[model samples]
Target: MPKIIEYPKGNFKNSLDLAEAVSSLGGSCDRESCAHKMGLKMSGAFGTKIGTTAKYELITTEKGKLQITELYKLIKNAYNDVERKKFETEAFLKPEVFNKLYDRFKGSELPVGMLSKLLIREYDVEEKQAVPVSKYFIDGLQYLNLLDGNNNLLDYNKSLEVEDDYAEIEDENDLPIKSNYSSPYLPEKPTAQILHIENKNNTTNRVEAETTDFIVHIMGPGIDSQIVIKEEEDLLIVDAMLKKVKKKLQ
Candidate 1:
């Protein structure tokens, strides 16, 4: 029998709210205390919420203690809304099933009608659980603004195109997919050395590149701009620019 992989039973927002509650308790606490903090009774429902948060990689559980994760800390302490959305995308894709689904349909439209069936057949989700899993996945993508009105995923190329009303937002979901497009803004001498930071399970937790000359695309609800990094000292200037966007999350 195939091992049934776990998934988040709750929607992304619910999972995030639970993570916020856990954070309010100084990042870690007993499960019951965390539940109580969220005004939820200690029942199967509450357990499911905790499990969902853990599946999102926003929180983790160990020996009856619930703790906010490093990913969650990064999300909570993000430099700006853009960076926060990037981290949130990482958290959303952390689940095995969601990651698999994303890999299959990232640059295309999601088959809404076939989502449940696909989950059951491809991801080993149970018959009864497939519907909710599919629902949660779509809801999560919508929450992250990664899905369009037609249910098409916003790919990296599509994300670069600016709309009239709203600015362009880089598709954080596409960060893992390396691009070979050489920009004239990038220096010609040194090639960017990409680095994959993997966790203990050998899964890539983050991606970083070791190059002083790279492009930084900043975009949000009403902002769209790009900065070229030609000099090492330019990083300090960019850091200062990002700091202007930093604000406490209410």
Candidate 2:
């Protein structure tokens, strides 16, 4: 007859280490207080399946404090099982939920920024457009493993909803704007004669003129006509003329 070896009982210190490891693996101990109730429920289910009635025992040895390898194994197994089940459930149901939300809000007065924020926080997503979220939702539904793919509790879509768009806006406002307009146009190096031209007429009149030297600066596909003069003589002449003009205009 073969002797059946009993599973090692976890001690107090071992239990503590196990719990810490589980938490470090992104498992929450908040239970009812957790914002994501599904995660809590899954964790509880795991604990129940593992026969962990009370907290696992923490064990200490002469060498030093030791983590409960057995407890960790049990909890890790439970976590993996619960994650798999949660992924399957979410995958099957998330598409319909996403579709309903998309249809309800598409082209509505609802602010896309706010809507997107809500979706990210609630669902864990990060798409700029609706179609991508919809597609992701479907993909999440098809693959259960993707739910906990990146040590993330929620899907990428849900993360997007939680992201702080205001922070991004504030970051954008910190950048400076550069312009390319100059008084005189010239080639590189110093020169004596600096010639400058001023358009007295409005932009519409200038655009209509056939003989106008339509100088265009290409920024991507768009064109900007704000001439930037860079010749040394032209710069000096423009500077001198501007000083005189300022006196006369004032």
Candidate 3:
């Protein structure tokens, strides 16, 4: 099985920039009364009058639009870096799997749609095939690989050394001869491991909050998928598939 590669975490600047951009659109906080004002502020003086009475009032103010604009720019920049790192990490960790896929169909004369279906099937076994022929071809390739080796030659099997329990049979002359039976050795199957990583520190809290709020404003609701595929098992599958392909090609 191939070794798993660790992906680097994304930079924070990109994520922050993305958040700022979304927040600057205004109507975000929904302060209708302060609409006329670009910014909002409140101040009051504490004083005692008569029987310890205090007066309070609301004050409205405006902040520079450039501040919001600059914040958005910073967040957008951060967001780009975050997304770039995500894609980079995904590709780096799954290079073998992606390479196998490219080698299997990239230069082939197969149609785009057919190639897509084949890819989908290879990656996602649950995908249904309209014509079972493709499945048969894939299965055949797998079987062929199982029987062959790197040089495309059948691997010599070792006989089992276990003691036989069957009774010996004698010929008419009462002479005993060994039976011509043997068992083939099977190669050990590869093992797989799955690992999961969770960020408990809320390291990207600001980015998450901003993104969530942005999505809610744009889509009327926020939805997030926390699933991340970062593990050794993926690399094992990639190695297995590559070996199978190599055996077939040879």
TM-scores of all predicted structures: 0.63, 0.17, 0.16
What candidate 3 gets wrong by more than 4 Å, as runs, is: 1-97, 107-110, 120-124, 128-250
Deviation of model 1 at 95, angstroms: 0.8
lDDT of 2 at 193: 25
Clash count for each candidate, listed in order shown: 0, 31, 15
Worst 10 residues of 3 by lDDT: 49-58
lDDT of 2 by residue, 59-78 (tens): 12223223334434344454
lDDT of 3 by residue, 1-250 (tens): 3332221122222223323332554413323222223333322211011001100001111241212233233423444333433332222223243334434543233333474365444544223432342333333223323122222212211210211111121111111121122223222422222111124344442234433221111010121212111332223233333333343456
Instruction: Sort the candidates on TM-score, descending order.
Output: 1, 2, 3
Error of 1 at 59 (Å): 1.2
Where in model 2 is the C-alpha error above 4 Å?
Answer: 1-22, 25-83, 86-96, 99-128, 145-250
Model 1 pairs whose backbones collide: none
Mind sharing the TM-score for model 2? Answer: 0.17
What is the C-alpha local distance difference test score of candidate 2? 0.33
Cα-based lDDT at residue 43, candidate 2: 56
